[model samples]
Target: MNERDILIVGGGIFGAAVAYELARHGLGERVLVLERLQPAAGATSRAAALLTMVRDDPGQIALARQTFRTMAELEQELGEDIGRRTVGALHAAPASHLAVLQARAEVAAAHGIASTWLDKAEALARAPWLAPESFDHAVFFPDECYVEPYLFATALLRAAIARGVRCEASEVKRVVVDTGRVWGVELADGRRRAASVIVNAAGAWANRLSVDLGLPLPMAPVRSQYWISEPAPIFPRDGAIVLLPAIRAYARPEVGALLFGIRERQPAVADARTLPADLAGFVFDPDDADGWANLAEGADELAPCFPALNTLGIAHYLTGPSNYTPDRQLVVGAAPMIAGLYVASGCNGSGISFAGGVGRLIGELIRGAAPFVDPQPSAPGRRGAFDPYAPDFLAACAAARAGKTSG
Candidate 1:
């Protein structure tokens, strides 16, 4: 019986951050992290790693602020570079979507985030590969950057481990509950462990662990895929991330090559129960069969952004589950009736962006400290009626992705 004060399941960005924050609050020696696979090896590794902080949601803006600050602090404390590239992000929108852009700028202003509107010539100067004629408006967020998500999560875990938090490679089959409160977790081998508090930060596969709970998170898994181009000088390594809302596309510099992804009309939705422990075991394209059709669908829209987009040598095609809720907000808070049980999943495809804040909020809740930001908007019970695996509910979640043009 390994008794601990805090036990966190899943060692992705969220879990790692939670463990690190708990250690920072003087709960290091008493914390335990159980990661079935490797830390950040799950969906966290496949994250797009975009840190576009000027978001439409003010809460997200506030949370993103903490994440940006925490990244720098981790680099300083750990004495290692997290590989953060401050190339900034350019949101290029058409006339019809100008209102949305303006609204986001206003929100950024209120949150003290720097946002500046750039003329077509200036925007083109930032991303020469992008087609200036395709967009009617553009805004630049100089603080934005694309980082290596794996490095970020592992650095947090390393710091937490240095503070005496123990982690083991073991899967948690279920959480132990008695007297309507969580006590510990039951492993696959029928072994039980004791912990005073348990936080579920299990990324895309989180629903599998929470379905039996009285209050399961109202979210489902959706496939988020992206492609990388072979090295090409046409793709500048120093260029800013280009976001085209009109065509539903985003591109960033990837080591002298171009990396990009375009949202599909109906993104693939999967039941977390059917997903494999290793994300590589899952297949994303059943309809397209060979996968070329899906590739072509996205390429057509992004073709105008780069002249060689269609002809470029595609070096890699990466895909992973990005959990989503209908409202497009994170699900991070304590379980409704399961005392001492907290969930920090439901990233809505922004897990990497929100991991720091999620960890901080969970730490605050468990320690009874005042939260840095309000967490009610993303509470579990706010919209919990939908069955995550149901067809209609999955459709709703996929619809959210289809309509999402920005971040």
Candidate 2:
């Protein structure tokens, strides 16, 4: 048996970030990361990687701020450009959502984040691609940023490795638990690696691993699809990220093209256990015509804002599964029923934005240090032992994905 102080499962953004944070806190030599495949080969690589911070929830807003600050400092600290782009974000909604938008802006202000409200005319002036009179009000977060998620995650892993953190390419077959305490993990090769603590940051596959310990986590995997349009003359390469929450649609610049996605009224749920053992070849669902129609409807709503989308040619379609909790927040913190076990999953589609903060908080919990943000809302057992595979839980996860706000 190979022994270690801490073992983290999954090497997606959350896992990479947690590993980096543990190493940063001087646990480098004692930490180990087990990745089924290469890092970020799953949803992390497929994420749109938007980092908009203006949110209605105070807890999420604080974490967003912390993640933004941490990501800002990482380049200097690690001496690597993680492809962080401060392109800002423009969120627009109809007249009915004016109050909600105002409250969100207020939350941003309270967090010392810059948020400027723009009327239809001013909004159009800033973004000429917007259709005339398409939205009544809008708010722009100038400090909001994004990154290439895979690159960013890899950068964190690289820095952690520099500090002596070890990463192995191995699939965890099952967790080895004894008397309500996790002591190690059984790998696919029938090898046992001992660890005093285990962090489950497995993203969509989280519930499967937790089930091994009889921990019924309320997290499910739902498919999220997006389209990347070929470079059009009307699209701006450096334009602010555009979000139309009223229609559940968003778009951002991808290189010289436009990357856009829509939240279907009925989100598609996937059984994580049945998914490809290696997610490297995952692709968009061709039979999901309803999803494409939803995107068309969203484009129609934005015709007044982005007229070019009406005639754009989609260059590629990308689809990946993301984990969601019943309440659509991250699940982080120690497991109440099990000793030496922690969870950092159920990102609800904000894994990239929340990675730094979540990783830091998980590190704090493991080290018995005071956390910068409260962990109650994100407690792993907060909802108390529910069947994650139950019909109702799955339905709730789909609904949560459709209406996900912090993405």
TM-score of each: 0.96, 0.94
C-alpha local distance difference test of each model: 0.85, 0.82
> Would you give me the overall lDDT of model 2?
0.82
Model 1 poorest 10 in a row by lDDT: 284-293
Candidate 2 lDDT by residue in tens digits, 94-205:
7887777787788878888898887777676556667766678899888887889988999889989998899999999888888988888999999998889999988888
Point to the candidate with the largest TM-score: 1
For residue 205, model 1's alpha carbon misses the true position, in angstroms, by 1.6
TM-score of 2: 0.94
Candidate 1 lDDT over 210-266, as tens digits, reads 878756677888888888889887677889998778777888889988888888888
**Which residue pairs in model 2 clash with each other?**
129-305, 130-305, 131-304, 131-305
Residue ranges of candidate 2 with Cα displaced over 4 Å: 1-3, 119-121, 281-286, 289-305
**Residue 339 error, candidate 2, Å:** 0.9
